[model samples]
Target: MSQTLGPTIAIDLDMLQTARERAETRGESLGKVVLDMVRKSLALRAPVPEYRNGIKRLPWRNFTRKVSIEDVNVLLNEPE
Candidate 1:
């Protein structure tokens, strides 16, 4: 199916430069890189489904995990 193009949007010079760099790194067009980034960001902002594997999961499950200072210190000490 053919998709309709959206209205023109203006971006700052820094944003334009970042998009160009991402395009070069991924060997994709600037438009494709920008669209992919937008899609990813939108997905993050969208609400997640409640049910998974017949279990009711919380929308904030990922963020609700407990993390202690010891865990952070252990991660920091891990050899790369």
Candidate 2:
């Protein structure tokens, strides 16, 4: 027994060509490759984290220091 279905999709010509090439290289049908990619894309559990402005204030002076005396002090002071 087998299932049959027909669906219309609009894909860019370049994308289709790339998919065909990948399918040939992997010895799989283009439909299988495309479906696997779709499944993986859908199965991702985490939503992309948005960057808030002014959230990452880096210490430029500490980065430029040849030896980080401040970093050593902070590490020593951190309680278990």
Best by TM-score: 1
Error of 2 at 73 (Å): 10
lDDT of each: 0.86, 0.78
Instruction: Please give the range of 10 consecutive residues that has the lowest summed lDDT in model 2.
Output: 56-65
- In candidate 1, which residue pairs get closer than 3 Å at backbone N, Cα or C atoms, i.e. clash? none
Runs of candidate 1 exceeding 4 Å displacement: 1-6, 46-80
The C-alpha TM-scores of every prediction are 0.48, 0.47
Sequence-dependent TM-score of model 1: 0.48
What lDDT does model 1 reach? 0.86
* Number of clashes found in candidate 1: 0
Best by lDDT: 1
Positional deviation of residue 49's Cα in model 2 after best superposition, in angstroms: 7.9
Residue 62 in candidate 2, Cα distance off native in Å: 19
Clashes of each: 0, 0
> Per-residue lDDT for 57-79 in model 1, tens only?
86565666689999999999999
Which whole-number lDDT from 0 to 100 does residue 78 have in model 1?
100
Pairing residues by index, what is the TM-score of model 2?
0.47
